[model samples]
Target: MALRGTNQEFGRPYNRRIVLETIRLEAPIARGDIARQVGLTVQTVSTIIRELELQGFVMGVREAPKGRGLPRTNLTLNPEGGFAIGLHVTPIGVSAALVNLAGKIVGTRHHPMARVSPEATFPVFQALIAEMQALRPKGRMLGIGVAMPGPSDVDSMSFVGPTTLEGWKGVPVRDRLAEAHVLPVFAGAELGAVALGERLYGVGREFRSFYYIYFGVGLGGAAVQDGTVQRGAHGNAGEIGHLPLVPGGDPCPCGNRGCLERYVSRDALDRRLKAVDPNATIETALTDHAGVVDAWIDEAAPVLRSAIATIENLYDPETIVIGGLASDALLERLLAATEPLMHSVAERSGRTTPRLTLSSDGQDAVLRGAAALAISGALSPRFGLLFAGEEERAERDPIMTGPSRKEVAA
Candidate 1:
């Protein structure tokens, strides 16, 4: 049922991603060894190696001398090949990181984004990018990946939010960044990106279907079905923040009363703690009202259990992960408290309860997810031209390229 495309054809641009993945998982490998490991022919591997070398994306290290006359050429990812700019944009602040191919943060920067629009944040983003660029003069650039507050058009790379990103509503973020930095640009909803990231490199592989709950300044959810995120017909499928759980509660930005976010988000917690400590900082409020936090979780866990049960009844995902600014400690407490609440929900619904787990990916889940989205898109057929050319060969003949098991791996 799948369309046919040769490794040479379908994997031109994808070669980089594949090679990077292979090297990331298995490093200090001979070029021929990597070719074999990745199913690419040695010739194709050589070509990729040469390309990566020219682009400063990969480097060759002379293998230790042995009984062999010539030392084997070992290839590895060049830490300076380029850097990916990851932005976790929130209403309160934007946390940015310069991540290398190995998924390590080489540099980090954070700034308050109050009343800031994309245009307004441009200078901050530019400075951050410049700082990262300065770190590796030999390297060019891959692109910028932004994990923004939802709702977003995945196809259009546009933001559609009820929050604080100014001039962000409908602007093609990719185009703007592409023009500004003269490099590829990618952006997506924080929750969607987190889901993708988890699926590819996090606990996402543990479940065929799972729900990712992101508790930040607001609350958001992402649903993964069959290893792919279900973006819905209008790309707004996972808008769980406005789930009307209360009959007559405080109003939400979505013009809905008793929205789930109003009851469970950090904002909600802050509002509740204001009575105890009117001048409490976000962290202070949380620390000041640990009991209130537990009480709120006691209330929220049932609602969350209901939400999880609904997902199970509808899609039957294997597990649910809680993430975002919600602390791991808080998530542990929430999970423990939700156990009884979930049991209650299961008793009422007469269905087996799905597993509830704290997100292992932590705050970086959404940002890493954005990077995964960019990598996936870059390797897709629609965007193959960026890396692979039309003149690229499909495969090499065994006669011409003897013992090409490595290329076959590619």
Candidate 2:
């Protein structure tokens, strides 16, 4: 069903999210365009735009002259209007950044960890968050977004399982952060966050639906449809790493054999590199040991190609992007190695986007994605919040709270 909204923000946070998402995606746009895009009336869009302007979230700039009449004022987000804290956690370390409304990273702090246990990591997380909080202007701080590798709450895999960070199984990851932090806490799988970052600031800005493949210490993926990441039951919808591709070939922490990650992840690459030189890290291995990297690509291309074909057939995304931890050069080589991809649903005539693509944002995809996750929670509507008390809703999201003065007056 097409999503239409009441011409008011009285209690409809959904409308607010739609309008904000439309502006962010198609910025420098007039209110009429926003209304048409989001299926809201022009008057409703004008009212919401006025409220957004009043709240300092949006500003209007006169459009460039084209014809005789004066150009309409186009709305764009006010970068200084709000900020979000993004934290990306991995087995190696945790990093945090303060991202502005304009999707710019204003400040960042990264600290490595010998162990990723909660006891050892929380102090660093808190310290970095405190630093970010101190730096951000008051009242504009939205929330904290935590992006970590996960098959959270799954019976087959867990957050604390052999593949995941230790001591995080059954640890309400977001709840733990929310308890200690003043702002709301949002958490997501690292790959999902990466996809969100892509949607918000990268090539994904152009497509309403896209697929993302993450080649980090592990392999994972995410799907975005109609500008929103598809978070499946238990938020583990895109845990493609544990997919059994090579039956009975190798065991996985998720109690599976022949999992895809075993053959195609950073761990797989590092293992290959470490065999050649014990001290060889992924970066050094790429620069110094090109042959080994090429061989690994040759071996992984088929596994990844099959996975890509499966994703294409299932979701039929506008594009398939490969990123995360894998350097651009490596991704390019891998993409090249997977030449003449298998026939799938993506082979439709007149396709605008390529069947597969590579991203340059691999290095900071998680950190930036963590920031996007927080921003999403702050602005996106939640059906759970629909029935929750106003106080609870306000506590959850400070940005979209209560009704407009016009609604109360009416």
Candidate 3:
């Protein structure tokens, strides 16, 4: 997902919008079937289908007959319903990509930060945004979504008091990014973003109630209930990183000792790596010490199992999705190591353990999730603009974007 391209805008026609949504949620269905699903007349569906075909938003291919009818044509979302930019900004580096509506990566960009301030790092973000903007079809640059390491407060659009970045505290990410690039901006907890992304595009579609455990620079989880990520009373419902896992192991930045993150987060992993090699980068260390990494996974199993059990006991979600900045390879290893450990525990308890699965998306799951938040927000006409006259507008909940904040919050 390199962000090295020219600035461009992609315009989406109104009819194409409905057609795209139909194909997105229910692909491989006939146009007439889509019309029936959306409750539009078959003639109207045909009209929209033609318009979408012209705009390259929908594609059709002949399929085998299901029964006595003639072979029908199945419709699908084109790989190019314009594209949205997704970014994950971390102390280690920034991962960026231009993702289409069908969830395909068109371009990518990466940059190492090594502990830089927001002001210093904004340039890299700007470059990536500019590149992504250029790559989008004319008028299609809906927005730029940047997912950073958190404890970020979504209500305030700022990083919470304690964070990995020095100057990120209380910095208004949505405002700064909007001003810097002159794009419609929305910001929130990176974990929330990742959870939302999964809810809309990934494992979330299968289960309404599930926990999204984000093991990134820090370990945080988000509780999704009824397709919406629960923000709790103060938008900190899932700060599992600060949860005490080891009472006397090590101090956490959130002023807690032996917190869950202090043991399972990348920062914790780096510290353990340093005891072996004084100078070790995360990517390199994980690559070189494969056996040691497996050992770490083994050590993390109980803690992770406990965390899942805690979430299950509390929320009793259908599934628990593990995802973060860790490589897909590492995720596979962790999944393999976790099964037997959890199964043994399940046997002892005389209960079946809930499903624990790794996120199928790339390392930048949170960033892609952020873009989902913005896209769902922008798609609704009611939330389009609070007032045509003023730029300042009301914020809407990500899941139910069309409703007023009061309604969504309630």
lDDT of each candidate versus the true structure: 0.65, 0.79, 0.66
In terms of lDDT, which candidate is stronger, 1 or 3?
Answer: 3
lDDT score, candidate 1, position 151: 63
Top candidate by TM-score: 2
**lDDT over C-alpha atoms for residue 345 of model 3:** 26
List runs of model 3 lying over 4 Å from the truth.
1-19, 29-51, 65-74, 134-139, 153-163, 180-183, 203-205, 290-295, 335-354, 381-410
Q: Which stretches of candidate 2 lie over 4 Å from their true place?
A: 1-22, 31-51, 67-69, 134-139, 159-162, 381-397, 400-410
lDDT of 1 by residue, 1-410 (tens): 12223365545665655665566546688877777676778788787677556555566788789985999877776654545667777767667776665555667777876666766777787777777666655444456787777666442223323343545666776677778865557877787888887876677767778878788777778889876798777656776777888788777656668778777777777677776778765554357777778777878776666666665566566667788776677767766765654432224354354477777777777766766665555434445444456334322210111112232222
lDDT of 2 by residue, 222-310 (tens): 99999889988778888899889886777777778888998888888888888988988887777799899988988888988888888
What lDDT score goes with residue 206 in model 2? 78
lDDT tens per residue, model 3, 203-282:
67787888889878778899999778997776577888877877686776566577787768777777778787788756
Question: lDDT, candidate 1, residue 163?
Answer: 45
lDDT of 3 at 329: 78
Candidate 1 displacement at residue 144 in angstroms: 0.4
